[model samples]
Target: MYARDVRERVDAGRWPDVAAVPEASTARTAITRRVLRHALGRLPLLVRFPDGTRLGLGGPLVDVHDPVAFHRRIGRSGLIGFGESYLAGEWDAPDLVAALTVLASRAAELVPAPLQRLRGLWAPRHPEAQRGTPDGARENIGAHYDLSNELFALFLDETLTYSSAVFRSLPASWERMAPAQRHKIDRLLDLARVGAGTRVLEIGTGWGELALRAAARGAHVTSLTLSAEQRTLALERVAEAGLADRVSVELCDYREATGTYDAVLSVEMIEAVGAEFWPAYFEAVDARLAPGGRAALQAITMPHDRLRASRDTFTWIQKYVFPGGLIPSTQAIESVTASRTSLRLTRRDGYGAHYAETLRLWRERFTDRAAHVGALGFDATFRRLWTFYLAYSEAGFRSGYLDVQQYLFTKDAARTDGAPRETATSTTARDTTTAAAEGETAP
Candidate 1:
């Protein structure tokens, strides 16, 4: 009989939900249980069961309440099912980020070597509907960014800067986040040589922060975004700042954008550009970049090997958090620029640890404002999903498996005379040293 039939029978009092009762079993479930047991035993984590049994060498603790359901879910959908199991209350972790950090650190070695090699045969691929075509890009971007700006404001700092911040120091305080965000924007502007009367093009107008800053610097800024929600709120914010005359926020895709500018700035938008369109995205940037102009991009990146291995495999992040997102590697960026455009990678600064801290602050704020989130009409499942997403991302940065970088690129014939030189060399050196110590590198 089907599992659902048995479940209905039990619920109707015809049968009891007990270990003594016969239950349907599948080959997939049996294999998943065995593989999971083997894998969990090797990791540096503590997996506790209701029966007082424990697995792994013990680091962060994972408490499993329904082993059968957990195994079944994983069997059916792999990592995606793992996330769903959490949403279903089959598992709990006292310290979610710590537990996930352990998993992320050992992610490459989770499955057996043979299975890892054969992943393409069994792993789920990204849905074609989520591909980043012009239309698909709008749909994909709207899926996340259109989720009310008020919801984001509950957690994000006042600046509404959704990307990573460059903190002045470690143990960042809540008071420092907004200033750090501005610091990061100013650095990108400096790298792009933005100045008075300069014409600037912002590829992704994230609530118009960069555009507002560029306008404040006396530059005429034209910013593009695909999200209708962002465009609406960004326009409001621009008007509030009284910079509407200098800045124009358009609900336009980079591919559809017209006109050349002295500087092109896209912060943390490259991840949303699918790998298939990376060349197109860069070509668009190159096409609009004025001669002797520079471009600055802030991107979240992964190791090249990891990027290649996971690019095609569907994950929980792709399914729920970011529909069409794919983190590129420094190698991928360098290769794409060299092969596709005249843009050359001039400088890169990695600050993954800062991103981890930023996420920590955001998660804490989210938790503290859970009631407000519920009041806004988001259900429990959504809250759990967002919690998992934020912690999962934070763990990735903590484990050195992911990094956020600000990259500076200049065209082949770019003139150097007007470009701004570093005024905070000491600070840059310190940040670079920390990044290097964390195993981050520039291409």
Candidate 2:
């Protein structure tokens, strides 16, 4: 019966159970159960079994329906197995974000020190095919961003912004999301000194929102993205706003991007660049910057120690959500810039709490529209996968395990061309001045 169900799911374009869960307990499974039992008992979380047994001291609740299967999965694959067990309905959480937050908060102490020293022996390494080479990058980008434009649209705001938004206040409402996203973009533009007649090069054009906003500032923009789906929609958006002449959206890789620009902008895209290519990525940015040009980047970051510990390990996020992605620590960013590029990190703003709120909004919206998502050809298992991904990310930020930052980099010296420094007032004025020209309201 279970095999028949799995076959049915596969035929319906759903997540298939490719690997069989161990049905019998082995010595390895027994050790896994004991280790997990000991670990959960120390955490301030409640792990309940169907037989009325429980673990942990009691906090957020995680109900294990098929405890044997859950233990077997974890015994086989560790964290990846934990996520797969969720997909396979072996366990569930009433408040997934809260449950995950509890775990994320104690991530560093989850395992014993002796076993921690042997992470390389137990953890999976990144696959060679998932490397961030030119061809690999295109394939990786397509795997996520090119999944379905409509699928993303269902969760993202009207602006179609995928990166974290800088909110003015906490407990951000849905109506404030789009404006907050625009504010985030304007802040980056202001940092990069974007204004009239500036030549802008944007990496990772996410549906052209940043490009449109830049072009609205009277800057000529060239935006590059590896996702062909993104390029198609971004070009349509550019044309729709009557800014086609000012904004050029190209389906190209960042390494292949040509020409130098006055300002360069990238948002939350560095995570996709593998650790091995960090130096090359920074070098590419350096090579494309004209003298005195500025570059602004919004990046999701983790602690330097955590990055070092997990940089080589393949986790659930790498396997199921974003293949070839690794969040860099701010220290890594600084070190790369110092060693590989002339660009200096001049200013940075951290808003990890805002990212927590942003993910909350997205998760709620995605949950509220689950039926619509299913109607769009996604099955229950796929929905569960994304739910886990979103909540897991929210928990990371909520627990302060992850953070997002906007960084400004200046080449050797400040602008020598006497371009007026951009201020909030100038940014708002530019928006107002160009709104009528573009036949649209200022973003």
Best by lDDT: 2
Q: Model 2: per-residue lDDT, tens digit, 195-311?
A: 999999999998989999999999999999999999999999999999999999888888898998999999999999999998888778878888888898989999999999889
Q: Tell me each candidate's TM-score.
A: 0.89, 0.90
Who wins the TM-score comparison? 2
Off by over 4 Å in 1: 1-25, 414-443
What does each candidate score in C-alpha RMSD? 6.6, 6.6
- Which portions of model 2 miss their true places by more than 4 Å? 1-19, 22-25, 413-443
